[model samples]
Target chain A: MKARILVSFKDSVLDPQGQTVRNALHTLGYDAVQDVRQGKVFELDLSGISKAEAERLIPEIAGKVLANMVIEKYTWQILED
Target chain B: MKARILVSFKDSVLDPQGQTVRNALHTLGYDAVQDVRQGKVFELDLSGISKAEAERLIPEIAGKVLANMVIEKYTWQILED
Candidate 1:
């Protein structure tokens, strides 16, 4: 089994990195860009685990280790292997 | 239009951050985790662009600004608004 996880700042939290990127885009003349949000992606290879175990572990791993619940949120999906 | 870009280190590149995370997960007893790779995600809201223009610009933006072509590779998809 395999899983992909996305960890991003909560909507209410300020993202200075994203703002910086947006400003860079503006400077590059990509004027159509209105907003930008930056996030992290984790690709996990759960090669020896069963699908059920992987499903159970993914959320726990994502929440407990991959994300800071106060300012960041995580979403994950099991990928077909 | 909206575009989501993913910038990841090429397979040949070393991902020290991901390795550190994997070590943490291992310490937490997730032995099933065989490998981990970390990447970046950028969600861009292209409010005023037409689909054709967005298609043309996404690659340009991703390649030139969002990713270091020498070590990182990027992929992107346009989303319906």
Candidate 2:
């Protein structure tokens, strides 16, 4: 099994990096782009674990280590490999 | 319309950060986690554009500005709002 976690800033937080990307796109002629948000993706390879176990583990792992709850939130999914 | 771009290092590239994450997970008692790979995600909001036009623009934007073609690979999808 494999697990994927996406960690991103909450909607209320300011994302300066995303803003910079939007500005860069404008300079490059992509005027249609109105907003940009950047986030992190973590793919974990789980060995010798059942899907049920992985499902239970992912939340704990993502919550405790992968995301900063004060400003960032995370979502995770398990994949069959 | 919205577009999501996922950028990750090529499989052949070394991911020290990922290794660090794996090590951290192991320390935290996640023994089933064998490996971890880190990547980036970008969500862009498009305004005043048709789906076809947004589709055409996503690749150019991801390839030219969001990802480093030499060491990274990117995948994108368009979303309806």
Candidate 3:
């Protein structure tokens, strides 16, 4: 199975990278862009595991290693079988 | 409106960051993980633009700045009004 995890900053956190990108976009003439928030996506390929097991383990993996829970939020979904 | 851009390495490209993360996961006890790929997601907030306009502009922005077309691919969608 394959799974996808998305890790992003909490809404209250200031994202300097996002701000930098936003400014760059403006400089590049994309003035319609108001704000930008950057995040990460992790795609995992799994073997020797059933989909149910993967589903159970993904949250744990994401919490412990994929994201910093105090400042970032993570969401995940099974992508393929 | 809000738009999301997903930028990922092309399949043929080597991802050192993903490999490092995979190694870390294995060391951390997620042995079921076979491989990992990393990507970026950019969330954009736009004003004075219609969804249709955003849809039209996103591809241009992604291609020109958000992703390296030679070694990466990007997809985007409008998220909200």
Task: For model 2 chain A, give the 10-residue run with minimal summed lDDT.
Answer: A72-81
> Each candidate: what lDDT?
0.92, 0.92, 0.95
TM-score for all predictions? 0.96, 0.96, 0.96
**Local distance difference test, candidate 1:** 0.92
Give me the runs in candidate 2 sitting further than 4 Å from their true place.
none
Comparing 2 with 3 on DockQ, the higher-scoring candidate is 2
Model 2: per-residue Cα lDDT over A53-73, one tens digit each: 888889888888999999999
Candidate 1: tens digits of C-alpha lDDT, residues B26-74: 9999999989999999999997768988999999999999999999999
TM-score of 3: 0.96
Model 3 deviation from native, Cα RMSD in Å: 1.0
Q: Rank candidates, lDDT, best first.
A: 3, 1, 2
Interface RMSD of 2: 0.7
Q: Report the Cα interface RMSD of each model, rounded to 1 decimal.
A: 0.7, 0.7, 0.9
lDDT of 1 at B54: 91
Error of 3 at A49 (Å): 1.6
Ranking by TM-score: 2, 1, 3
What digit string (tens of lDDT, one per residue) describes model 2 on residues B41-67?
999999998888888889999999999
